[model samples]
Target chain A: MNKSIGFLGPKGTFSHEAVEGYRSGQNKAYELKEYHSIKDVLCALKDGEVDEAIVPIENSLEGAVNVTLDVLAKEEDMFIVDEFIIPVNLNLVAKQGTKAEDIKVLMSHPQPLGQCRNYLNTNFPGVVQLEENSTSKAAQKVVDGDGTCAAITSKIAAKIYGLEVLETNIQDNENNHTRFVIIARSLKAKTGADKTSIVFSTDNKPGSLYRVLDIFSLWDINMTRIESRPSKSALGQYIFFVDIDGHIEDPDVHDALTMVKRKTSFYKFLGSYPAFAGKI
Target chain B: MNKSIGFLGPKGTFSHEAVEGYRSGQNKAYELKEYHSIKDVLCALKDGEVDEAIVPIENSLEGAVNVTLDVLAKEEDMFIVDEFIIPVNLNLVAKQGTKAEDIKVLMSHPQPLGQCRNYLNTNFPGVVQLEENSTSKAAQKVVDGDGTCAAITSKIAAKIYGLEVLETNIQDNENNHTRFVIIARSLKAKTGADKTSIVFSTDNKPGSLYRVLDIFSLWDINMTRIESRPSKSALGQYIFFVDIDGHIEDPDVHDALTMVKRKTSFYKFLGSYPAFAGKI
Candidate 1:
């Protein structure tokens, strides 16, 4: 029996696209399931409802997805097995025969709406904007609603929902992209060009984080991204999420993480996975 | 002559509370104006619609309020004139005759809705939750709608909107607090106990950020907080928002930031204002 994979979806979401991308690279056919929320998608995998789960971790335009990072940090027995990057191409999509001028209400997940802020302000100023859980759900709303509604969503979502694309590349930034990760019960083997992600909180001291970063620098490791999320216990406390080049299998990477684990008050190694080298 | 202050408001939101707190500490009376969004509030200040604007900068539970930070970073001539911290006390409010059991739908701004997730999960289970622009707006919605509606809003909002408190302190964390900042056209004079906030983007190279952080460490400057936001240019590129303990008038802080500016590709000096030391 093939393993089942879970994604955040009502179908036609970017997470659904990531699932399709993952499937294309795999040798064996796998079952796919859609969970409504990112937390639900990860929890389903942990609960054995699925063997793998894919969810977005970061966007070029929107820094870190805090809920995803928070869930990954809090949950035990979860590891990233792969990584994927997808360019966010937002389109003004509506029902067939609906003109752009007729769009009185625009809808999307808050992200795409924000990504298209300039476009929306320029093209549809004063239009009522609504938020949905997913861009695909927004597309679904456009399909179900009266002719005055449109959604800023992926092309796949428009096609899947049988909506017409009224405008294309509606995002404010051409470089907009989202990075997604595949989470599993265990980590994957080293793929040479891989990245390791970890979350750790330091003692409430001035130079504590710098000391931790010094360890990576001393080991000649390259950090690709760094983000800080509030620890939720208090105002100033934070957990640092960092992605660095090299997998745990690398000798330097192994040594540096061992040092990092010992130095930090709290630490969690999220995973080591092959880095996505596609157009980001 | 009295100055005018602006805030993101519908008359009874937490921003309204922040404005009240600020007014209490002032020596002069000021005219208060309300803007619909964070950007609008800040832009109003920049556009000379108000002499100052108060906006939430960070929450103990939710971390940084990105819109406020992004707007401050992008706009010119905006400076932090003051800072205020208020404990976020969320209440479940409804019409006077409505009971907790009568609520079929709940409403609040997305932030408060998220802050009360566990509480809602335990109490309401699957109540239909709606999002409004502000908590006060949510309270107003409860007032205009049928009796079977409730809002998670501040105590002031419940009173102003003439709603009954069904439950008090519905937030998940007791430590929930939001920090608001007063932005003006000019910076405040240095107070001995002050914090300078700056946003800078380092070259996308290994050890580049570590070196910039090294400046603070070298000057013995204490950094209170550090957060990364996307540069909005590309993936893996980030602009860092840092709050350090000391005003620009402090020699060490001045020297460290001067070094930081010289080292970074892009830099912006947000402001230096007296640190809020009342409570965490």
Candidate 2:
């Protein structure tokens, strides 16, 4: 489908990198739009400015990307259609001619900041820490300044801004990975390696939740992740985010999820998408 | 309580701030202890080096604090008791004589990097950004560097480091809050306004979770927060972390939670503690 995918930020952000994952010749044949923030991207999708949008849902290191989840929970019309697990290679990018020793500050998004800690402390010893919209924004700041400044961003950001890469793959852990989801106006195509996401609330009885989980066990479908967000109604109330292996079109998946819908006080289907986690 | 609390670092870290809220001075007296790293603090608590530990579970602006949560979820026997919400104020603290412009580098915990985005971009602009364990550790780094640098930290951290505050409450959103839970060697003594936390997994089926939620709705009892961590067992399984209003000792609350225990494949109570959120 030719969908204009909207994502958060300018040229060098990770979301931009993730959007790149979806753009095979098939997807790039369509238009692409970029926004400066998650809210803007969501708004663009809601306003019908884009056929679909990509927003980060979580990171292995950081956990839930709450912004997208919170909005999707409230935006009744939207649903996730596809997802990508991008292996993040955060770099320490700096303006041309800035020596590593000359750098006194390190700037990047907060998640990258934590992901790159061991290198910074051991190398710079005591440099200033700063924040930016995304790693690419940090690269832009360094490009604009052209001083001892440097930024931790994706290699793509460095290439985008014509900056030199001071360090490659500087994340504290080499296994850094981020998961992004593609959201659409409604459910569409399904890939078999697909995973279905749903939100449901269990009644507060002892065996109620156990009984709910039993359905999947009985059907023999696999659940990958399960998370809960506050129902925001009152104390003692919560809604859960769950992931199961297999597409909704698959009989077992559909049968199990349908059964859950009947018992839950609250329920919503997020989507069924192939788990496209590319290797680093 | 007479329990000694272990946090991430020596002084003025987010854990220290969380301690302020989690500590009720109930059992005996709560003593604050500092560690150089999160692992150390948790290991200490697990080893009986400390009575209880205060750890950050999630950040509202940035999302889940994975490092802490992952460890808590993986480690058995230990569980969450109660949680408190604390506002994260990232301040630019420098030596008494240093001016904002004179500040060459900024330092802070990696997490706060995003929280102070607009301020860092506008004021320090292109200055180097560095990351440390927490705002407190960042302050110590700046202090060690003499007048050459400044750190972004809690005001309390500034006092601990004997640094003057260059900027106050430098966070992106005024509503930025962090929810921290107290994990102890065993269950805790009850404080007024107590909240109960539990973990459970339901059979994977339709309406399984719904039946569980119905327990509380029927009781008119309120739940505060609910989160699910992958059971990371046997595959296709999950266990949820749920916090609810009223002490476990309260009849309705006890009844509701007790019934929920039977509905899932697994269930564990984190704890109950006084809701220490004092003033907004």
Candidate 3:
């Protein structure tokens, strides 16, 4: 594998924070590659410009990131090889001397707005609002502020751009965690916390969904998450994405997948990688 | 039954559009009412405040509106009656003198971002962004801009505040459709194109999911959408909320539900409402 890995960014993003966490986890050698979009990063991987990409898969609060799921449903080769969670904390930042009281407009991404709806509705009652591309972009606007503006962003953003933090931990939920999945064209070294992700389309009959589950049950393999996304081909057919404990090599897990393959019209192993500890 | 209408605001919102849509479709004499939150609206119906409420279920470009699903999964004695696909045209509104060139910030709800992702990505590449509670709230901020700021909102919003339309049809997908459902505490007065929604939890055993589906097949019912949310109970168990063609009262749909009931540990009929009709 290459030493460099691409991450989603224009910098100072939670995606960037996830990249930071991944890099810090690697106590060995590596260089960081960054791209402004998930597609761009995924493309770079396709071109062999990078070894892998870290894509945000889900948030505890928002459920699955459908964009990643949609893209994954099509790409046949990429496997989700590792997973990580990043605790997000955003601040209201602005150009130096833009005091909280003087702030006339506040901006952030839509997800952050909903996450911090409680803060904005209560503390900043009747305050003028705005939306930006990414929280980091919001941070950039704070620097370019003609005054009268503030941004909901990470503290790292404020420090990186010389802005001041007006508020802290502004999201509505205290236990906010976003799950990120590391994807590559091939498998990783397989750590002990391993879990296999697979996608399949089953026949539209009674006990069809149950019959697939029977494999996991009989094998005593536990599933962590199961998501249903439209197959996009026909109206009624669907693709089920499930993550389960154990590796592809494990006899019980292999047997379950083989059994499911026999019963379902279609099935594919998405990846086998270490799962995050205890967020389920 | 009396109407228990719902809009997403303390008093004003685009949900009001869906409410008006429902009003126009039903007999003109049917009474209409409102609520502050979607959950509150569902509660009003469950606790018997009103018969049915209008709620936004999904958006064409944005996919599912997760909040509606989250609330519906838990609420008792309710199902979608009729679905309206409301065509949306977002206009960038500004205070009278604010020029498109002078506007430094743009604001709206997250819905608009994905709606107009391409437009913003191309034309407004570096503009400052902000997300608010609703397009109405964003309109309010632009009205109070007190600076060079604008909000992407509805034409009605511009009319309500006497603002200028700086931009129009700004959504990424020109055919932006928001599907709003008329929900009630009991089965609706069947309008012909009825669809039934139900949630069920089967034993967490292999073949359990498949067996449940065999019931749907036995009756030859068409399932349009199937989604899974966390059981939020013990781990490894999942509750599937399914939408299928035919009202529960129909012979085949009736037989399907009856057989499904026997196989699942639990089942609940959310409601039998008119099938969702995409924008006409």
Candidate 4:
């Protein structure tokens, strides 16, 4: 069967890169669909228009992507079947023959601009920063605009828009990477080495989350990630999205999740997939 | 003394509203200055250009503003001396005499647009969405553009920019509120009912964060908030930012914090402030 994957895209985004990387890794033929927003990507998955949706969930520099986490928490049917991490390599790109000194306006999405702040501050100094809807849009802007503009975007973005890379890997952090997750209607068959993701709201008591984490400690499961997002009910209320290093089929993992469900007011099984080791 | 406050602004943003609310609540005259971003707000505070800075730190729907959290985590001298929760009432505004039916383009900062997603999807259908640098900038865009353009922004922004309100409180969630924090160089004198905010990164051992929270449980301190941000050193490493229901002057809070500081590999004192109850 031909699998289909949906991603938040404009042909040359990091999301596109993630899907491409995943597709090549599997060496399988698949159809790729692009959506403008993370919400749309999830909606397509829920509607079964695609077999799986790959969306960014976390960045080393930017932390958790709230839209993805919130959607996962709210959407009961969707499950994360796998995860991917892509090293973000932001390039300063512009139209061909645009001199570096002539560029007065820097453009990109907020995150990439933020990640490259130090580079911008030191290099551009007082250049006017114009934020576009996306990095690809920024690259498109550079293509459309006069020689005074440059965009900090992906190499793929430059290739798509036929822009010239003035500088490569311009992000301040050399170790910057973004974590993406593959979401589907059902979980993949658990391998021995797997990671389980879940979201749960603790009982409204002091140290409720601490007590929940105690269960994982008792089971000796290593947690890979823990993020607390607002439950949207009140100011301090939070639903925890956690990824633990064990498959649901494992007895220890199953027991730990069962204990967590018993202790919390809300419990959601987000799914188990092969554990993502540092690279894609 | 002429006290001054810096905020993220283009004259009429929520940051401007926050400063206004803080100023009127104090009933003291203070010079107000506006900056383009939270980083600038913090820099002004750090450089003593402003007596303090008031920037949105968290939103009920949007979660913690990562820019604010990361800055609070990174900047050593700055402390969160106060907190304010403003109920976010996003309004659909346009030029005078412009009707809702005539509106074709909707502009605003991404967060406000996200908060009002349901309202926008239902009312506007497929209206072209525009992203501006700030909500106030969105209002300015509507003012600068044709009558068909409308902006999703604050009531204050509408008033400041002379845009007529087409609809008020357009946010999908009535409980939508943004939590703003006042940053200063030194802590305010601790009140009896106060909260202390601290950031700590645990040792990379198994169940590390759980063990740190256990100390808070042992002290019987009621924690008001807890968040984990990327330590920025690596992908999996995280720095836990915690707010507990007590003043650092209190013995229990002091002891718990002392233990937390001892347990963690890196620890930073964010500051102690009066506990925020609903309104500022």
Scanning candidate 1 chain B in windows of ten residues, the lowest lDDT window is: B125-134
The two-chain DockQ for each candidate, comma-separated, is 0.69, 0.16, 0.26, 0.60
Please identify model 2 stretches exceeding 4 Å from their true place: A25-28, A97-102, A117-127, A190-193, A233-237, A249-252, A274-280, B1-4, B7-18, B21-24, B27-52, B58-64, B73-179, B183-280
Q: What is the DockQ of candidate 2?
A: 0.16
lDDT of each: 0.88, 0.74, 0.74, 0.87
Q: How far is candidate 4 from the true structure (C-alpha RMSD, Å)?
A: 2.1
Instruction: For candidate 1, give the docking quality class from DockQ.
Output: medium
Clashes of each: 0, 69, 36, 0
Please give the ranking of all candidate structures by TM-score, highest first, separated by commas.
1, 4, 3, 2
| True-structure lDDT of candidate 1 | 0.88
Write model 1 residue lDDT over A41-66, tens digit each, in one string. 88899899999999999998867787
For model 3, give the TM-score of chain B: 0.85
**TM-score of candidate 2's A chain against the true A chain:** 0.88
Tens digit of lDDT per residue, candidate 2, span A201-280?
Answer: 88866545555677787788765676666554433345668888889899888888999999888788888877764553
- RMSD to the true structure for each prediction, in A, is 1.9, 7.4, 5.5, 2.1
What tens digits encode model 1's per-residue C-alpha lDDT throughout B257-278?
9999999999999999999867
Best by DockQ: 1
Best by TM-score: 1
Per-residue lDDT for A95-164 in model 4, tens only? 9999889998898876788799889878987676765556887888788898899999999899889999
